[model samples]
Target: MGSDVDFVAYVCEQAGLGGALSYRKMFGEYALYLDERVVALVCDNMLFVKPTTAGRALLDTVEEAPPYPGAKPHWRMDDVLDDGERLGRLLVATAAALPRPKPKGPKVARPGAPRKR
Candidate 1:
């Protein structure tokens, strides 16, 4: 089944990161990004945080699972739905550990364009 919009919103809201928090639809699921770094993924109404030492230390109980088929095991954080503070901290730490996203090159206009009268 496909993930619901409300679920995605709820996850982002709970993350509580002041830095640009955004999500994008991918393969009918959602990828949650904090400051351009992908922190978590919402698939089938479940939250999966990227596994990191800092993130793992913050969790009370660690549960490893894949966000989707053939994906690597991540830190499943289903219980964080109600804890915005914890969720926010987790996301922040996860984002900090992840490498910064590479800058996208500017798009160039096509040559031989029609001239305007």
Candidate 2:
């Protein structure tokens, strides 16, 4: 009986994925994010990641049920979830693609917009 924290830490440690990989509670489960981009998830001690060259490969090696049901197949990409190398590559790729957190600018009125009296 592994919890979200346990699984998340395990993934980061096991896969040796660098950068900040966080776990957020979503859809009543834990969503895995690499540099703030959702890349995978941990549910019921099962790992389900989005489709990627590495992620797909991970899914390809396993034949277990995916985290989310009503989905096409087991795992997100395929039915298997193995290969730490792929998982690491996937995490690195995802981390590299993460969008930088830009400072929010103040909203300004649109052109020709009426001024509030």
Candidate 3:
């Protein structure tokens, strides 16, 4: 029920990163994605990032929690950002790690193909 477009934009803007980002409704919560791989989410006004193993190791030395209960937490860079450079680096890293998705095209039928009965 919440508008995530703005939230996602805000984060992307603040981080100075951009790409073909989009969103879809999932189980009543909004799931945000960069390219095709999920990147983050806005739940209850708190932003959470997808936990990549590499990203996990980055913060493993510190304690962290999932964005929401009963689910995995976003990459916690909140406490570590004493300046914009650190935050931007974290965002860019995650953005770069995201897998680029192949373009999905519309289904087509062969010529003279029989119609469904």
Candidate 4:
């Protein structure tokens, strides 16, 4: 089943980060980003944060699970929905530990393409 849009919105609001936070639909799931770095995923109404040392240290307890089949284990943040402060802190720490996103090259025009008049 696909993830719920309302759930995704709720998760983002709970995080309460001041960075460039956003999400993209991928294969019926959602990929959550913080400051252009992917921090978590919302799949089937569950929040799966990347397992980082910083994030793990912030949480009181750690629970690892896969967001989808055949995926690596992630820190299953089931309690974050009701705790905005915890969610925010987790996201901030995870984003800080993650490497900056690589720059994407500009798209090239097709060879021998006609120029506009």
CA deviation > 4 Å runs, candidate 1: 106-117
In model 4, pairs of residues that clash are none
Q: List candidate 4 stretches off by more than 4 Å.
A: 108-117
Q: Candidate 4 overall Cα lDDT vs. reference?
A: 0.89
**Of the candidates shown, which would achieve the greatest lDDT relative to the real structure?**
4
Q: Judged by lDDT relative to the true structure, which candidate is superior, 1 or 4?
A: 4
Query: How many clashes (backbone N, Cα, C below 3 Å) per candidate?
Result: 0, 3, 2, 0
Q: Ranking under TM-score, best-scoring first?
A: 4, 1, 2, 3
What TM-score against the true fold does each predicted structure earn? Answer: 0.85, 0.55, 0.55, 0.87
Question: Model 2 TM-score?
Answer: 0.55
- Model 3, CA-based lDDT: 0.60
On residues 1-117, what C-alpha lDDT tens digit does candidate 3 reach at each position? 554566656655565545555567665556666656677766654556666665555454544567667876565445643454554565456666777777889979889999777
lDDT of 2 by residue, 1-117 (tens): 434676667776766665566678776678777775777777766777654454444333544455666754434422223556666776666556555557779989999999999
For candidate 1, lDDT tens digit of each residue in 30-108? Answer: 9999878999999999999999888987888988999889999988888987999999999999999999988899966
Candidate 2 off by > 4 Å: 1-3, 57-66, 71-84, 94-117
Candidate 1 weakest lDDT stretch, 10 residues: 107-116
Model 4 lDDT tens row, 2-115 = 999999988988878654678999999999998788899999999999999998888888889999999999988897779998899889899999999889999777889986
Answer with 1 or 3, whichever has the higher lDDT.
1
